[model samples]
Target chain A: MTLGRLNHVGVATPSIEKSIPIYRDLLGATKIHEAFDLPAQGVRVCFVDTPNSQIELIEPLGETSPILKFLEKNPLGGQHHVCFEVPDIHAAKAEMEAKGAKVLGEPRIGAHGTPVIFVHPKDMGGVLVELMEAPKREH
Target chain B: MTLGRLNHVGVATPSIEKSIPIYRDLLGATKIHEAFDLPAQGVRVCFVDTPNSQIELIEPLGETSPILKFLEKNPLGGQHHVCFEVPDIHAAKAEMEAKGAKVLGEPRIGAHGTPVIFVHPKDMGGVLVELMEAPKREH
Candidate 1:
């Protein structure tokens, strides 16, 4: 239940390439990180850095990708979930479970290379919530 | 379309009273400000301050409230929209217009008593985005 920061907002896009101009030209956003394909997650992702947090643009990797299903419903894509940082993944998972929340699965490595898990939207006020362990601070 | 900072994530709830326990007991969230009503907006809102930003719990104030439509589709409530701060509302509006983004209406006073406007979601990757004029720093 302890949260550190809002790392990013997961945005589902039909095509990350096509969506770039909207954020760049219309929003005046620069410094977009290179897009990457995360096979384990069945999606391609690009991080658009904002001053305080990031907008994670995600695209389906294949026809069978879950993101494809989401896109089928929305067509144009939409907000998928919000990711927040927690100091400890295991503890956060346990805390959420203790309060009767439904965690989708065990903690798995996410796009940021940090352990992450998603809480079911039904148990989270109809909003799919992602909790990720913050990258360890370099001393 | 320049942005200042993330002000808060707007969450639509059927009842803020029922939703409080979820955030407070489950999410370990504290520092919930007193709930207030915005007659013009026709919604009651409460700001739950988080480590970095805030979660805005909004409930329709009356049958004519606009939030009613959102709640009708999502009875249990859900993440509504995300708000970002803008240094200058007028300039940001012009910038978004220059690139063909649809601004919902003229600048109006938002919950925080600052000028704000909503960008049509169709142009924003299916996300309803709010742009608020940032509060000037006290020198």
Candidate 2:
């Protein structure tokens, strides 16, 4: 299974509003998409376009948000996960399991509307990794 | 200062040797570079090339390594910092300072042999960001 791409770096922030300027003003990112809430994922997300990949800014959406614990520890936000695109999600999952890497949960539709799954940090050398199914090209 | 690329995502690990297989076997990364020690920075480093960017795996090289405290906090290792390339390192440093972001230190030759500076995490919305000067083009 060849890794498709370094899709994006997930950053958990307390406030996407507070984070935008750093990417736009400081990093000179010209194409930052509007922030939106992903209720299913329990986070609000915005994509900051870079020449090659993107910076995914994620903010907690509800009190029970998954990232709340992370924010509680960090208090100021930080890198949460790094996503890599894969051609096939199920194959990737099977390979991971076969290799003794634990998948956090079944693949679900991610922020980009593509199937994605998270690998446990312990299995991923302490960094949470998200394997996202690559979007199909229009014929 | 337009961001040139999402140069690499830095992952702090206890051992780069242990980290290489996850990238090569699990992620199917074919271009795993040789791990080498950077004595000046007190870390051993390796590059896992993705199609668009790279994942920099860094391990503490000595007892005085800068990432020692981080490793102490996160025993399993974790995402450390994200590096972005800029056309001019000096201009990027000045702009960050003007925006009230504290530059970690004077721009110094970084892992890639280009001048780079780190912006304080507090100023970058709780994320540590490295600004690297784009490599000069060979004419």
Candidate 3:
């Protein structure tokens, strides 16, 4: 059970700028990473780090983006996933699959280039979850 | 900046037994705590601990509970709140208020007799976050 610490909670919002102040000012988080046009995921993201865990705010880049659909249904926004830091994302995925849980994302590059995967919400009783192996910290 | 770590992520579900196997076997979580008929909150809760963070499954006791309303709005269950392990919940609440965040619970006793306060989602950009303070052993 050499799991790492939980890295972050991913949130899907319509705009990052609108969400930043709540995290930075209210939660005492600071902007640590930012990226845009993730063509693969069809969203732009910004990561804010508090003393405890990171907060990832994502905004859809196009009308066709899955995030756009999510926002349409949940205009007020909803949590995307509660991510847990794991030692080996690949191994975790394998173990989860063996237990009959549906795995969504395979071990793959995620925000900030960390290896990550998702356990289906249905399997977890309706909470989307992500497992990530910490990537190299960047300044 | 010694803030607390994320203690757990709460989720409102329709059933706890159905959700256990996924969390325990698939997500590698172990059942650490269980509380039933919390009249104060009108829900039954089960705490599942992973190596890094805990997962709380909440089941509404009746249709009168607020969680029941949340489920009615979004049939698909979702993440509820990010619970942070703080050192002084009062200090955390005062700081949050000073920074213009609305306090929900206002430093009250929570699930495990820990002093806790909830920052309103309206103040957190759609993320319901709880600040908890009380010395407790890590699982």
Top model number, DockQ = 2
lDDT of 3 by residue, A8-88 (tens): 788888888888766665665544566566767677888877655677788888777867877887676768887777777
- Over B34-116, each residue of candidate 1 has an lDDT whose tens digit, in order, gives 89998888899998877778788999997799889989888988878888898889998888888788999899899888999
Give the per-residue lDDT digits (tens) of candidate 2, residues B1-139.
Answer: 7867999999999999998988999889999888888888889999999999999999998899999999999988999999999988898888889878899989988888899999999888788899999898699
What lDDT tens digits, residue by residue, belong to model 2 across residues A72-134?
A: 998889999999999989999999999899999899999889999999999888999999999
- lDDT at A126, model 1: 77
Which one is best on TM-score? 2
Measured with C-alpha atoms, the lDDT of residue A38 in candidate 2 is 92
Model 3 regions lying over 4 Å from their true place: A1-4, A35-37, A134-139, B1-3, B134-139
| Each candidate's fnat | 0.53, 0.91, 0.46
RMSD of each: 1.5, 1.3, 3.4
Identify the superior model by lDDT, candidate 1 or candidate 3: 1
Q: Flag clash pairs in model 1.
A: none
By descending lDDT, how would the candidates be arranged?
Answer: 2, 1, 3
Sorted into a CAPRI-style docking class, model 3 comes out as acceptable
Least well predicted 10-residue stretch by lDDT in candidate 1 chain B: B1-10
* Candidate 1 Cα misplacement greater than 4 A, ranges: none
lDDT of 3 by residue, B33-104 (tens): 664666677778888776556678888886688689877865666688877777788888888888777898
